[model samples]
Target: MTFPQNEVRFEQLSTASPSVIYSIEEYPGRPARFDYLSPAFEEIYEIPVAKAMENAAIAFDTFHPDDLSGYQQAVIRSAKTMQPLQHEWRIITPSGKIKWVQANSRPERRQEGVLVWHGVMLDITDRKQTEAALRESEATKKQILKAIPDLIFWMSADGICLDSMPSNDAFQLFPDSGRVGKNLYTVLPPDLAEMRRQAVEKALQTGDVQVYEQRIMLHGGFYYEEVRVVGVGDDRVLVIVRNITSRKQAEIALQESEERFRSAFQDAPIGMALIGLDDRWLKVNPVLCNMFEYSEAELLTTRMFTMVHPEDRSILQQYIEQYLGQSQTKDKKATQVELRYQCKGGQIIWVRLNLSVVRDAQRHPSYYVAQIQDITQEHAVNRMKDEFISIVSHELRTPLTAIQGFLGLLNTGIYTNNPEKTQRMLKLAMDNGDRLVRLVNDILDLERLSSGKVQLAMTTCNASELMQQAVDSIHSIADQAAVTLAVVPTKAQVWAASDSIIQTLTNLLSNAIKFSPPQTTVTLSVQTQTDSVLFQVRDRGRGIPADKLESIFGRFQQVDVSDSRQKGGTGLGLAICQSIVQQHGGNIWVESTLGEGSTFYFTLPTPDP
Candidate 1:
């Protein structure tokens, strides 16, 4: 509504209000004059109505010179458009008192084609002073933020770059050519631009601060940035970019180092572990956990001592204490030692555990960096090699003994004088030749298995009959040991190469007979399980120790190394059995109790129904 009309209406009210009312007329390029002066002006401005009506410009002439030209232009433009003129100006009276003045005026076109302004002017000095002070404070605050070394920027409600301070490093890092006055989409790297735009838009819509990390392509090279976006005045946004390249490089170096460790951990043909400061495992790779038959998580949660074989724990504990104590000492640095750890299934594994210390900034011990390697396989092979040397020595003696016995007979010349004695010597010589042939065959079989050169003539046959045939073949050996041999037959048939199964069963039966006590029964049982047929050979002789049960089927492995050849057999028999069973998608295992007896079991797949 027009202020003049409103003031006229306000005066017509029967009930008087406390509001002060006045109207004025303004001319373009001329002074603005009060056309109507109300008595309320005297109280509002502390000036008489006649004094204000006489000259409106007298109150405004004391305004700051900087505002005079702008105010004059505003009135002129308003008169031309017949629009309203609204402005706030400062005034200083003759008494040297400064005050704020606010004026609102609308122009009217007269019939004479001249435009005249009619409006109202109120003394808004108090409100104007407060607003001026606020603007000054805001200018000072922006100067402070701009002075910081970091890049600070602001985006508009639509994601366009509205204002920025310091430099355009933020835009230079992006793949886009130029970013000034452009939207985030136009300035972002092609791959990540869309993502960044979406994230910023989402934050704007939700009015929430968003934080993220990204690799930005800059003129120099790629850089990692930690970015944060916060909502500010009038739907604007403040974004900050922090350079975290050094921290990222450190993490990458650590990751690469960890990968190197993993390669050593998995492919080292040994088990490894990462232990914590308190002797607990913090990390364990596949091989390490696999050696102990424990899951990685399960191993990590348990203490290292819990897995140590009890017999070696005290000795191992001392080494562990010494290593850790040395690593913790300021002068000692890191330490490495070889120790024994028990598997989850009560197997002792010899491991060479190498340990180092990871320290924090405070130089305090943080964690134990450990590398555990299981050397059981190596140890087993070494022991077998020693046994093999002994077996070779015994084998060498067999021929020498025969030669020595014949020479002794010749020394008496009794074999030459007596035809029967000479014939007995010839027979003994032939028996020794046969024994040498068997020894050579055993060695050749082991070579073939190790080189993966053993090929099977596969044929499906009845599993029970194969067991019976092997039992019959070993019957003579059982009789020599004075051990009764029994075969428990099964009705189930299997699909496998008959000859291989026969050979596997023969080895098991012969071992049972050789190890059995005189006149004790050696039982051979065949039964059918869900997917495979089971064959077992149990003897009444002294059983194998639990520690050696798994390795019994390995090449050149023997329960009693000293008597292995004396028992009239080669150690490769069980190894061949294992190879045959594995070739047919089956397995062989042993259950033994020390000083009792052993049961050797093998499985063959049942024929398809």
Candidate 2:
């Protein structure tokens, strides 16, 4: 067929559009006919156009049976209203392929009981499938959000709440406002609103996820939240809020407790140090630094064992070696030990040290905490008291034993027949009696001085006269021991209690005479100075051992126990002398060479004239 050029172009456009144009007549007993059918008929329904044009009833056969009724009803309604007919329906092609189609046209009533409709139809199969998939995805996302129990919100760039999903009542900060068409500033607090606005802007700008935390108070309890914002298209964001109130509360409580413990460790009155499993000091307090005479930095740099006294290191070393062998429990604590520690100045002081292990989160031993207290003076006093008890028991038994024996012999009439024999026995008994009296007197004198029951009578006296009187008092005892007393003449005058000075000197002379070898000279020398007088009593006796030099001044302590028993020397004389010298504001000490001799020196302060 021949056609004009414009008509040919229009025909090409229809063929390329892949649509069919149709006309319908609703006249009585008249059948509908397709006035035009594009080439798409064969491509879509698997039928040629000429066949569809011959009879419209043939194309109706391809309409899905389930959709045919709805399609017919929509067309009839549109025809009655004389409105544009728009409808969608499913069709099964002759090749058994299901396809979706849309019809768009206007219906016109030509006469009574007669209607003419013209429309174009196109395949919408891909669009319908895409829409169904989108619906399904949206449903899945909703289900997931519900399951997580999170507060999800969609907000615009201007901080307007577009949509939201509600959570539990306890966590719902804005109950009524989590809806569409609400501004964030109107619903939330001023601070939070501004923060969320800034977060929204940042998320939109960077196209990256933004996270933050905020605290809110509700119902007199603090609440914590975590907010995450992610940008969607068109300057909108999706914000997810999670309530972390419980977790935050736990963290705060833990931090506060840790801080308190840290403060206590730094400021405790007793010495404290934190040592690690490797026996290194991690930290030390001021008291510990003062006690050991080390600076904080020095202690931290030094090892714990280096500062322990050599004699007291064994037990501490044993613990360090067996640390790993102890119980693997975080709650287990180590026992305490009393030991000596060396100061920076090389002096040793007694301390009670307690150790406890600190653990990490994995229950592994991380470090150790050591608490120490100085007990040097207390321990010395306790030792002295124990020695006093032992000596007092022995001294009392000796006197009681002699008195019992003499009384028993007298009652038995053992010396009854001979008067001279009785008199000799009586004399021997009297000698022991006198010795007992002397021992008791020494005990009382030591007790009085130690307990501060005796006051010193301060007076000025000549040091030479004091030495002379002491020598004279011990003259007979020196002769009995075959020892000679040699006094170094000193013209020094001193302020002191004459009686107390005389007593101290006499005690020193008696000890020298008792321990002296035969024909040895016991020399008494007085070194006078401006502030004090130093007196020395030197004896050529079996000398004291090095270790007992300090302890000999303690009650009942002797370098050799045999010395206390053999020389008829009660251990109380030296203790009494020490007390007397100390009460007079003086110092006393002893120096000895192993086999040469011993010297006792004491200093008495001289009052200013």
- List model 2 lDDT by residue over 437-521, tens digit each: 8788888888888889777888878899999999998899899889999999988877888888899899889888888899999
Q: Compared with the true structure, what per-residue lDDT tens digits does model 1 show for residues 97-195? A: 666667777777766455655555677777777888899898887777655545567887677877776554543344223444788766666766666
Could you tell me which 10 consecutive residues in candidate 1 have the lowest summed lDDT? 13-22
| Best prediction by TM-score | 2
TM-score of each: 0.40, 0.61
Residue-level error in angstroms, candidate 2, position 59: 5.3
Inter-residue clash pairs, candidate 2: none
TM-score of 2: 0.61
lDDT of each: 0.74, 0.84
Off by over 4 Å in 1: 1-98, 102-121, 137-171, 174-271, 276-278, 286-303, 309-311, 320-331, 336-338, 343-351, 357-366, 373-609
- What CA RMSD would candidate 2 show? 9.4
Question: How far out, in Å, is residue 487 in model 2?
Answer: 34
